[model samples]
Target: MVYIDKEKLKEIYPPNFRLDGDIQKGYINEDGTIEGVFTLDGFEPCTLDGMEGLWNEEKRLFIPNEVAEQGAKSLVGAPILAPTPKIENIREFFEKRYSMLDCYFENDESVYNLSTDEDVLKKYEDSKTSFVFLSIDMVKSTELSLKLPLELNSIFDNLFLNEIASIIRGMGGYVYKSVGDELIAFFEPANLLNKVDDSILCSDYIRVFILDYLNKFLEKNNLPQVGFRTSINYGEVYVKNVGDKLELNGYNLSATIKLQNFAKDNEIILGSNVVNIANKKWKSRMKKLKVNPRKLKKEGLHEGMKVYRLHNLEGRYD
Candidate 1:
């Protein structure tokens, strides 16, 4: 996820900017003045300098217009854009232009059985797509969910999904699916070194962002705290959409999820695939770990796959 200084944003756009819908539908004239809306926090929609881009709902930051353009380009998986009118509306522009995959939360009851939904199957023909897969799960979610009222639990889930997914999108990653407490997402693959850099930066930012966001969330709502464990892998996977629903299936996707089992709270696990493509700086932060598949019984992992954990972020931004 792209990290923006909240105080810096307020200085840039002031307190009156507006954030609405999925995108920040407002105004950014040529003079550098911004007049629009912003989602300051996941649930609170407020006005600010209107920039024609997306917003990271949980973190309450508008994506820079340039970054949004980059995200758009990546979403299309194409090299060049034909001359076209500038897109002012985020949802209208993206929905009309890009075929986005679907996301789910853990408690969702939608059956994954392809045979049961023939109509759905017909709508979402599969295609091979390359992306960097990020699979994350909230630690001790069952106990936490049980402690809260169902309505409040729903609020928490919604908050997590909106913020987390928005951060991914802002960083040019697409959320493929979110089931139960597990969220699966991917970044588009590119031959460009900058794109690879962005993917690693996004992962780093997310690791820090979640720790900070959850603390504030729990404190604001008077709820108990929670933790995150993430595993990232990069490769090709079969992606399909049925109606508005999107799903990912393939070995790479499964491998990413399985790798998460070895992670501890507040840790970011990187699969060998992610490590292979990451820059030297990122690679240096990874420490190799050996896994025993016997410990994962039903997790369906092959024996002796290597995974790495990112470490020492405390002084990273210092």
Candidate 2:
């Protein structure tokens, strides 16, 4: 059975970081002490070896075992892990090989089990991964829906699921979640520097492709035009498997959704985290705008809370 060195972990995290819940079978020593337990938050049952710490109950921010030991009040005073690691290649491998629904089912088998099997649940444990979160929403969706007939709505939906989503996947990104006309995607860049570049390339490609191709498809079928806006931020998130499917949720994901509201129609807006890792080449494609510094004070980004608007995808190398 897999086990954690409880004493070592505690020493790193301090008194408040207590282990709760039942210890897994066979991990209890003859002394009746349980040193390790299964996690519902990692890609594999043994992936904690790569993580330095855990998030608190509120899921506000990651608390490194070392910082917790130092009596750090929260992640603000402590140094949280910046970009989450792309620990597994599951999405990148399967997305191109299968349809979105098929890919989701292949990775999230816990949803198919009819019995309450511990092994099945264990097989579905989520992995904590670092990724770039990109949220795309159709601009004036309600108004557009009202104007379109049922056939046109169907056409638009097909364009998103087939065309737009495929473009993202082709660029080594995943359209992990969606609601109505909005899509929430995650891109696992190899390193911090690649996060902004990857997101920019995908977003720019989607924008240009839709403007060029989608319009032609609509014209051929005698339909109206549509526009969209994309917002992106990068950080750690839990890719969890529940009853019917996998879900991506965490502090960073939530923040990205909120950031999406700040984007104007047909524009791609980036958060501070993306801006921080962006190089001169990536930054050149965008124009930086300042946010209300006072509004960002609580999030530890007040010093320079800026968002960048994409100017054009032209001249981008990759």
Of the candidates shown, which would achieve the greatest lDDT relative to the real structure?
A: 1
Q: Provide the overall lDDT of each model, using Cα atoms, as 2-decimal numbers.
A: 0.57, 0.56
- lDDT by residue (tens digit), candidate 1, 151-265: 7776566555555565566666666667877777766555433344455666666665555554554676577776778888776777676565666678888988888888888
Please identify model 1 stretches exceeding 4 Å from their true place.
1-125, 192-196, 241-246, 293-298, 315-318
Candidate 1 global lDDT: 0.57
TM-score of 1: 0.57
Minimum summed lDDT over a 10-residue window in model 1 is located at 77-86
Task: Give the per-residue lDDT digits (tens) of candidate 2, residues 1-318.
Answer: 223344555654443322222223424334433334422232122224576544544323444443333321211221212222232342453333233333232454322211222332234358776778888877777887888787666446545545556656666566665677787777765544444566676787777656655555556656677778888888777767777666666877877776766677778888877775565556667787767766555544434657778785663322
TM-score for each predicted model, relative to the true structure: 0.57, 0.56
**What ranges in model 2 sit over 4 Å off?**
1-124, 293-304, 315-318
- Assess the local accuracy of residue 109 in candidate 2 as a C-alpha lDDT between 0 and 100: 38
